[model samples]
Target: MSPETTDLPLTLSADHYHRPAPEIPGAIALIEDAQVGVNLAMLQTGALQIAIDSQAVKPGDKLLVFIDEQLVLVSLVERPCNGEPIVRNIPAKCVPDGIISLSYRVNVEQSAPLKVLVKTELPGGVDPKPEAPGHFLLTPPQLTPTTLDGGQAETVRIAPYPGMRHNDVVMLKCGNWTLPHNVTAHEVGQPLTFTLSPEMVASNGDGAIVLYYTISDAVGNRATDHSLGLAVMIQTGSATPVAPTVSGVDQQNALYLSQLGSQTVTVSLDTRAFTAGDRFTLVWSGVDRTGGIKLFTQEQILERQTTLEFSVANNTIQELAGGSARLFFTRTDAKGGEQQLPSREILIVGNTRRVSATEASPQQAPGEFAAGGS
Candidate 1:
């Protein structure tokens, strides 16, 4: 038998129902990956609660999203709670200067997506660290005067070392205000030459002149505080005097004949005595002044002589005087040659003492004089 189709009545319960749609717009904030898992937050309102888990979010997580037609950002937030996602708002300007460390924990479940609006302003300046100060600021090259070899020069090259590159530009200046020449920079530790104009040379004369220079870097960052000044002196042609030579003589003589040892006889002379400015030498020797013996030769002053007299007591000449006695004398010539006189002998007989008298005679042969007579 065929069954007949039937319709039945259905009833609905109010206990099991869906939530109403949120009236306000749900906004999301964006943040950087480094900020994830750290404390962070974003500003928002309304019942559109934060959702993440079913959306798959975790601590230290990173996501790229848009923010209200302003700009897209990357953000990270602490772990979501239940099904809520955490979000934070970081200023774009703050991040450029330094990292904006989150000071508080952010709820990934309820907070909106991270969104940062960057405002435009004038270009920022560089700030040097306190520990490493900035270098001097140098400007573009300018013209300045330069002095070289005691003359003024219109052209000069400027250079810097350790911090400068080759073929850099530099400016030269005279005094504090006068600009003279713009020069090309060369490698440091090398010298540069500047040609002087007639007008510049005339003004500089022979006196030293001061010049200034500015050394710059390739990036246009100038360091003018290191300006240096150079002094140029004129060269003169002349010769210097040489030092003179010096010498001395010391000798001693005896009045009697006896075995002799090295003698230190005192000899003195005035340098001014020689009309020809000739030098003389004084010699001491075991050889007698009469040419009996020779020990050594020494140099003495020209034209001047000093007398040295002493006595020796012994059995040899004692029969002639009460004891031994003799006399000796030496004369030096302008050419440093020494001339000796005959030894003068004295005798002592009974109670009488006799002195031999003889004038120094170079004409007689050496050692030819009588022992007891002149």
Candidate 2:
């Protein structure tokens, strides 16, 4: 029952533990109230310390901690202290990028997979969830073209905290971008400002941007408090758009299969922020009642392409007839983020067109009616 054993507040998740290493993957079975959680403040300098309930597994079992699905850390269980509890430290690079999912294993198979929604890497001596991270009060929370002075730089005020001192680093994160600054001797215990350049603000794109700053004191302590965040919006024409524009057919347009032999539905998005290699998917829905084929879909761009000409085949159109179909396109960024526009619906007229029939009875030699009455 050492003080460090408190780092793991929860039990190892799976009651089952496999032999070790590769054998543990297929041996995990989530059972009962068993669980594992993160103690941010307890995170050591270079490794993750986990506590396992002595009653959960026997001594000498191996423990594995996976970060972001990669087996980055491993440790062997130490003997329990009179059934008090056991703490095992897995020495691996601890990174909380995006969303962090950490799981534990004993021996080969038993597992208690734990997913903690922590997005910051906190070093020693700081509360993982600090009451006040940095004095990050944005000068003007909202930004438009006029107020922003055509993408003029915006300033965020970061006041010194109780432990603020020189050599401490302050890092500001806006949307996906970050800006860093050093705390000067004169700035200690005084208000500091981080400037967001026009390009920096624009890089965050449109819509609400989460603004928060982390502090790494001279003593090497870091923490980010995400409970409340500064919400900033920049509505420039070139910023990342809120959603893509699905063009070609609108609700007012009723397509006739006879006329539109091959249909092309164009999707327009802000190419100003388009990143190559990102995937754009055209989701065509609302045609479940159509005949022949119930679903319709197409793919890709504009010059960003204005005349993208992503054509739909006649057979697809035939299947999509007899009902109104809606289309929306989504952009999947390289980081696996997605943004899509509202769906556009088009009414389809008539059933799927079929090949015309030709009657081929021998024609009476240039003349008479074939009917008996004649």
Candidate 2, residue 309: CA error in Å? 24
lDDT of 1 by residue, 1-374 (tens): 11111131111123421221111113222323322211111111101122222244555544322223222233444445456433333332223211222121112222233222221111111212211111122221223532233333455544333344333334443321233332244334444444455455444223223344444332233332223234333222132211111111101112212221222223333344233424443322221211122223444333333322222222322233111112223445556665432222111112211121222222211211111111
lDDT of each: 0.28, 0.45
Which regions in candidate 1 have their CA more than 4 angstroms from the true location?
1-160, 176-190, 203-208, 232-374
Tens-place lDDT per residue, model 2, 132-232, is 22222322222233223225777677645545655666766554455678877788777777777878765544543345555564333343321123444
Against the true structure, candidate 1 reaches a TM-score of 0.21
Q: What lDDT would candidate 1 get against the real structure? A: 0.28
